[model samples]
Target: MSAFEHSSYPEVAKLTIPDVSVAALDMGCLPPVLKRFVEDGAMRMQAPVDFIVVAALCSVGAAIGTSIRVQPKAMDTRYQIVPTLWGAIIGDPSSMKSPSISFALNPIQSLEGEMRIGHKNAELEYKANKKIFDMKLKQVEA
Candidate 1:
């Protein structure tokens, strides 16, 4: 099993987002701004498994169930941030955990029986912040 898996554009690329970020409270050095954002409701933390982040500016792609493979672009080796990612090469819908779509990539492979906001062909814009990245695996039809 790989360390980081995610869903994103460019389905043909394969990337491993580095899960290494300096601690937020490392006062001696640059603050863990990312952790602060996750703590202060400004940003978010990573979820379990191939969960999608249809809510944030950059959505993560995980190859779980019936999903696509996102190829990773080369690293820039400059910017320093939490969860550094190698930009995807191609955008693939398989990266998104669509309940309607089905695949088998690992120990977890099951069909998405129903369609909801955050699952399958679903997405949502939060009532508080009208951001496209506020996607979740729980959505109800209007």
Candidate 2:
């Protein structure tokens, strides 16, 4: 007998999942400059404001690095927290998440490029200086 024609198996009921409700993002919570940037990015890229906001905040945190620290308690210095932030943007495939992240991190990427160039130049200079110093040392020993 064909699988479809078999009547011995019991019918299974379909499962229904309820929709989840999420609170809307409040623009007032963000700084004026950041609010403006997020708004502009959302409008221009046709992306969600939440995505831009999260991306911007993450980028800012990465840029800050571990340079600044905050003591949560006034009296106690034992608990120190770095201002670093990590976040993830979860959405459907065509929700513009990638574009939002790229736009938000543009400034950081530019800075990184500049830093890379500077580092390369410094490395070259160090190598040249080391070569000169080695030559001088050899002459001094002879």
Candidate 3:
């Protein structure tokens, strides 16, 4: 008889799958400053610390951009890891996930506002320079 035959296997009255267990977040794993921020935000918003921590990590990863990379193995320089990170805070409706994420990303949002202003100023300067160059070219041609 082939082992693949259904009769070869023992029949069970019932099959049970154990529940998945998730470990709790360890605040010590985070830097002191970040830990404090997460703790404060969670307390004030009455949200889970995990949400803030994940948001903070994602924000940092985005802020770093593509300029930085990590080498998993020092001996193998061929492989490089980007700082890109994606995170989602899963919670039922009325949960404080939105507020927690907003709190964590506040600093990043502020920086983005400043960067936008700088970019607008640079764009205006470029337009002014281009107009001056065009006038100079017209004068030289005539």
Candidate 4:
């Protein structure tokens, strides 16, 4: 029971996500969760939902239902959710415009990934800074 751990301390803030491996995706193997299904002889996302919080939770839920094990790096939760919502909307190519299927998507630029989704760190900063597009104005004697 340390003084710092207590919520009463003004400096102490609650962690949005605990240090746990969530949203781990295995791109190598066949997707066991979502399998093709015959909806009026049309193949569609049947089992493992990806966009989230709709008919099937995993595909659309905020919580990490499926194991998305990839690189150990910080990623933008907001940016990541965009693709999920898009996938759900387009997963079934021939389906009617199911407006009830509520999902959100907005543009996101990969600034870097540690500080604010995509702002290059020191190592990457050095590489990016290497290409400065500034032109120096030479001083001429008047």
lDDT of each: 0.32, 0.95, 0.93, 0.35
- The candidate maximizing TM-score is 2
Q: What CA RMSD would you report for each candidate?
A: 21.4, 4.5, 7.5, 19.5
Q: After superposition, how far is residue 23 of candidate 3 from its true place, in Å?
A: 1.6
Q: Which residue ranges in model 2 land beyond 4 Å of their true spot? A: 1-20
User: Number of clashes in every candidate structure?
Assistant: 33, 0, 0, 21
The reply for model 1, stretches above 4 Å from the true place, is: 1-31, 42-142
Which parts of model 4 are misplaced by more than 4 Å? 1-30, 37-95, 99-142
Per-residue lDDT tens digits of candidate 1, residues 1-142?
3434554444676888779884333323323542333233322222212232122113222323125333344575454334423322223554434421121122123222333324633433344344433443234321
Q: What are the models' TM-scores? A: 0.13, 0.81, 0.78, 0.19
Q: What does candidate 3's lDDT look like per residue over 19-94, in tens digits? A: 9898999999999999999999999889999999999999988999999989999899999988679999988897
Worst 10 residues of 3 by lDDT: 8-17
What is the per-residue lDDT of model 2 for residues 1-142, given as tens digits with 9 covering 90 to 100?
A: 9998899988988987669888999999999999999999999999999999999999988998999999989999988998779899999899999999999999899999999999999999999999999999999999
- lDDT for model 4, on a 0 to 1 scale? 0.35
Cα lDDT of candidate 1 equals 0.32
